[model samples]
Target: MSLDTQSPGLLAEPQAVQATADGGTRLALRGDLLDFTHQPEWGAIESDAVRFREDHWLLIEDGRIVGAQPGSLAPDASWTRHDHRGRLILPGFIDTHVHSPQLDVIASHGTELLDWLNTYTFPAEKRYANLVEAETGAARFADALLAHGTTSAVVFPTVHKVSADALFAAARERGMRLITGKVLMDRHSPDGLRDEAPDFGARDCVDLIDRWHGVDRLAYAVTVRFAPTSSPGQLAMAGQLCTSMPGLYMQTHLAENRAEVKWVHELFPDARSYLDVYERAGLLNARAVFAHGIWLDDDDRALLRDSRAQIAHSPSSNLFLGSGLFNWRAADEANVRVSIATDVGGGTSLSLQRTIADAYKVQALQGERLTAWRGLHAATLGAAAGLSLNEEIGSLSEGCTADVCVWDWTQGSVAQRRHELARNLHERVFAWLTLSDERNLVTAYVRGIARYER
Candidate 1:
């Protein structure tokens, strides 16, 4: 179904016959249903906060969830029922920060942030200059996300505009909710991967925005790779794009590694702090997303909170690059929005489960506890809220997109025990987050279409 950004709710409802734009069958899932109700931070994640229905029916029509009910009151079978009885069905995962071009660069060894980019990232991204390569990578990347049960993502393509075009086309074909943009980098980089500002990089961004933004479920992000890579002029143009376009999202890296943070301070010497660089460019606000806020201090936290900017907490990437631990508790206490992500390439894997597992370890090393409910929320609704897309894709609420995942807790012996021993819903979620992998995914749905099944 085409989702018009102006009126996303206008997707025509299916008639009583139940059909989808792709001519795919609607989802008639019968299982142990699960979905978030509110941010876990408000209070305890008890029955009132999370919807957990035993032996329930979740109906999806025309790419939207039409109804959810317990077995006793479940509608009589009319359409095909995909029985997931004895499994856990929840909203499909969403990755708030990821590099679609970096899929091949994942697990590249022996480099920190900046050097890693120069040695591995920039070189790998240079391949996307070939549209065929970018499209091929896009196809593989799309499958990888679905295989891991991630139905939606906020992706960063290469500096090449064709990279964003290729990935956007691939995602559009699959009917996934994706936010991506061409990286605006004018300086401090390799030859083939760089683009000039004001005339070239800036204009290409506008053209891309017009070409892809609001087309189907796809949206555009005004991605300025980072302050260090982008010249003052390039950043100014990025800020202009953000201001000119009402709903355009802004994403970039920030305070990820100590050296990178120090360099940002040196590069933008007049700025107050690392976050100040973006602030100076008029790029700090609710629509902006800064990834890897690992080295942020109290002042930076306050700045982020006041500006209403969001942070994409990429635990796996932080660990892989030896960047630093993210202080989740401190960020929350500071009222800075935090969401989880798999910062692939720099991140070890694309699996949100693996990302959360690493997040648990990262927080533990810092003498902080990352609750399972909070982590799960960060991967789903919290991530969507960070991008201001929660109303459309985060939950299984009525009228929300039918992006869902069914997990088989009976996959392994350990899973079986976790299922048997989980007395509370929180415990069950915790076990799944800790032990479950992509292998446990029985099926995954994006816009009422099964994208992955095993």
Candidate 2:
């Protein structure tokens, strides 16, 4: 039996059941579906593997994909049909590193890395103490992320526990897959920004884990503002928290600027390298997501590879701050899991498309090319792998959550002209990469529900 023969009643029901082909049950997608799986680009070393299918039928039930095929539907099966023929569909983008409270400070004038933090980042982050302000910021942050086709993010809130709570609360209301935590810093910060005591800060982090971790789609992270601002005592406590909470994620900046690297050397003279500071603190592991690994040596790369920690490549921020170009080839050669992200407010744009564009430039500077398929994968499946969330949200594979993005491939005149001239799926993908932005995202869906539509 063909899927089209299946009655609409079955598709309308919420209960998910396996449908036998002979029993006349089939599922269908009612529009032009651009399944990212069409052409899979595994990574920097992998060959082109992305695929594209036209006039496709995707069978989803209970927020999980049950089946997908080209050109037809199962017969005698009931299916929920969504007509999106003129749209482009892809997996929801995953932003691996972002500062939720820093939403207000994005695009502020900045010097270099350390100076930028002291001048703009720290002072802006200090305002999260008020629950009302935090709540407002969280909501705006969530809205901006969703509007830009980001269904999941690993966010950094301010040092205030209320800030983390605000972000988690906002995420819960939107059914977003979010990871966030309070910034833990006990020294070297402005007076108002410092936590009263290291132990007290650690206790708050522990309490937050119990309260917010695993709540709905929310996950808690053990966040440190890098080794410079955190003393040995605080780092040790954070490491203890990681040990106690085996599955929690660890996020912090790493080797982004020359000054920061020099400071790490001065701060931990006994440590072999900057990465060693975190390694000795028991914070290096597969669950850890280190942002901006731009200045790493062979030793640092090797240690990171051995520990299986992932890197969140923020190309836009790196370029905007004049930090340095990230060695994509080096990270790939070391077998490190790499994911692309818009590290906004430091990252000038919220659009993942812009981030991808920046990544291409960053790679070009290193005499490499970042293909469109690979860029999309990095923003989706690659990111999901980095976050250990591949089974849940990365692809539109069977049993994955139905978080998806619908793009208007010809959203603008330039894009339309390019689309008309493009001959194949790969060319079209490249064109979109070069020309598209958040403006091309027609709709954003989370867990089978539409959250934003333009």
Candidate 3:
């Protein structure tokens, strides 16, 4: 299942893959293993929701986790060992919503969502029309995600077909589990960046899907740039593709800001709410992921729950753009699937740690505390489950792909002191989450093969 046989593209770095007598790779990671078994309750962390094996050896054969043994392996063991004793070995982070071409626009000043997109995001993405620019950016962006401990992601590429092609090519070279598609926006966008014609955009998407979807670890998303930018015909075209193409994913923004919500209401007066616009287009389904979703009403949530669609909680982006706080508890109560993401560029980082730290603060502003378990789950297993890829990418359990990251218990001296003073696993993990970032990541592995190192 590994893409290691393919020639390294722009970003592949050399890493050893152990060869066993069976003519397959075998390896083990020795560390403090942790992953969520299920979704945890709100406001407080539950012990049962977590699976923690202290100082365990996570066994891997070929590209999947075979078992997790609690002690050292036999002295004559033939497997290659990457000893990360005293560190945390967990599933690689999964980012549900992020823009790949916006890597250069991160940290740019902006007034709000629309303004930000015009001033920074659009210009950066416009560059992707060039094949060289698209390939170079995609390669650097994929490398950056792994460097930040993200092994799997649902991405947003530019409106150019070349953008999605370049991104998939880069991901294939690195064996990353990546999903993206050419963005569709036929109106309200700049001349060079807009699709210009809905039918042409749909045709491009079809061609890209035939070429890339389900190849290696890559998948295609039917990316709509929100209802305002897409006409009724364009949205219908996107919906048609979803129905025709089984297992295809759909991603778009939904009520991310109050103004954006109001704009949706004005644009689609017949629709009940912002989500209703997409619903009427037949775009609501289990594979659909709407970003932000900060302003959805109870009725909208009920619709999402019924549709089995998901909301991607992008805390950093919300705070940066003055988007409202996400009602994590409310969405969960309504049985709506929710996952955490970096929403990069609009978000301040590619680091999920920053996103999770901001998530805690956002929930706190709403008079709720985000447990480390809840935050960790949202980024790891929960995100994977949202994409219906949990059985493959989100856990260290047997039969799951071996996409993993090793993290130090603490980073700076102050963070180390806090961890040392903690009285329990909960406190230690909270401190680690608050204080850690990509710098704390010792290494990241995709399919039991090391891909990034500090």
> What's the candidate order when arranged by decreasing lDDT?
3, 1, 2
Any idea what lDDT model 1 has? 0.84
Q: Which candidate has the top score in lDDT?
A: 3
lDDT of 1 by residue, 20-125 (tens): 4566556588899877777886325564557678898898877789888776665554555677788888899999999998888899989899889989899899
> Residue 257, candidate 2: how far off, in angstroms?
0.7
**Candidate 1 weakest lDDT stretch, 10 residues:** 7-16
lDDT of each: 0.84, 0.81, 0.89
Q: In candidate 2, how many clashes are counted?
A: 25
Q: What TM-score, computed on C-alpha atoms, does each candidate reach? A: 0.93, 0.90, 0.96
Per-residue lDDT for 393-433 in model 2, tens only?
87878888878777877776878999989887767877887
RMSD of 1: 5.3
By TM-score, the best candidate is 3
C-alpha-based local distance difference test score of model 2: 0.81
What tens digits encode model 3's per-residue C-alpha lDDT throughout 55-138? 988888998999988756531357888788889998999999999998888888857998888888888888999999999899
